[model samples]
Target: MRIHTLDLRFQGIPGLIASYLVESGGEFALIETGPGSTLAALRSAIRAVDVDESAIKKVFVTHIHLDHAGAAGWWAQQGATVYCHPNAARHLIDSSKLIDSARLIYAEKMDSLWGDMLPAPAERLIVLQDNEGVPLGEVEINAWDTPGHARHHHAFVLGDVCFTGDVAGMRLEHSSYLSVTASPPQFDPVAYVQSVDRLMAAKFKTLYLTHFGAVSDVAAHLANYRQRITEVYERVAAGFREGISTEENRRRYAAAEHQAAMQAGVSEELWLKGESANVTSMCADGVRLYCEKQP
Candidate 1:
């Protein structure tokens, strides 16, 4: 089986939302459809890799997040069997609620930013429980429950590569650069740590992150990710102990992240434009999750 990386140009940034196409024999499987608005990028990337759009007979989504599974329903409408976590099955079939919730969080740019998400008919959506193995053409993807990033998250292991969604966190380009974005409401720091450990124990040779491309040294990366996330949350937890207000706390937290990124050797220009915002948002989410778990 051959795996091709389809980079979705999220916010015009490369490697931000990578979808993969796994090929075997005469069939192909698309993993993570990216955001609905970014389907064109997905299509173009697939085509560039010599994989026909219609050859994608199945889709395995790690979760139902807009950036990850937003286009699952759309592709399912095109005759691809959509495979997802059982808890996310209903949402894929009737994405109205999920779309609206994302809109509330993302606001006015929801449609323009993420594109339209067409619901997959219930019959076309395949819901798999943890440890379920589903056939994708000639390959069998072992879908294991990989929650913590989200309750419904699943990581698919095919051959030597594991398509680890956000459960593996962000690994931006070279430089051992990493950041964990554990968003609020559903973000559980403890669960996230456990999930990291679970992935580490899996001993996969390489991990394909939704944020970018492949990461080898899976164990080391997971360790660094866990450490970074812990530090971010610990900083926030310490603030909570001092009774710091949310607004002040967020400012302080963002500032510290900015300095850390700079100290880590990230360029000043990149930090000002994109990297900084990503780290700040990640830190904010990590902070929120840590506080929620405290006491």
Candidate 2:
């Protein structure tokens, strides 16, 4: 089996987003669909690899986040079996609730950032279980529940490469700016740490992140994810407990993170682009939400 990394080149940002196309056993599978806005790029990328869209017999998603699965419904409509966590599988069947939840976070940028989310037919859904290997003739694709960024998150292990959705965080090329993709609602530091540890302990040494490309320094990356995410959460939690407004926390965390990234040698242009492209404020907001839930 061969895996080709497809750079969606979201919003003209070179390394901000990616999806993997795995060809094995005379079948094609997409690990992530990216947002609907990138579907044209994705189609083009697949074609460049000499693989037709109709050859994609299966689709695997790490989560239901619009960035990861916004075009999943479209893939399902292409006669491919769609596999996702049960919690997320239902939303693709009827994206009304999913769109509502996203509206709460994205607001007016809905159509611009992610585009329209269509509903997939229920028959195309295949809910996966933790540690379950997908039944793909000659290829072994195992999935495990990895909830940290989101309760419905999971990482797929295909041979030596593990598709670490958001659990792996964001690390752009040419810069050591490793930022966690801690979006709203469910961002548990504990779960995030555990998931990172699980990925490190797994047999797969190469991590294929949805945010970017392949990362082979497994130990260093997982360690950074554990330490830095905790630091961010702790900083934001203090503001949340001290009655800081959400807007204030966003500003504070974004500034602090910006300084840290520059100190770590990230260029100003990339830093600013990373902030907007990665939505750095949302990570702080996620930490604020976690702090709010605490008594």
Model 1, C-alpha of 213: deviation from truth (Å): 0.5
| Model 2: residues with Cα > 4 Å off, grouped in runs | none
Question: What lDDT would each prediction earn against the true structure?
Answer: 0.80, 0.87
**Candidate 1 accuracy as lDDT:** 0.80
Residues 108-202, candidate 2, lDDT per residue (tens digit)? 97888888788989999999999999855578899889999999998999777899999989886746768888988899999988888888787
What TM-score does prediction 1 earn? 0.93
Residue range 1-295, candidate 1, lDDT tens digits: 7888888878777757789988876778888998889998889998898777987888999998888898898888888899999889988899889888878877997888789988998878888888889776677898988777788989998867799988888765644757667665577777888888988888889999888788888888999888877777778888888988777777887788667767777676656544522546545755665586667
Considering summed lDDT, which 10 consecutive residues are worst modelled in model 2?
272-281
Candidate 2: residue 38 lDDT (0-100): 90
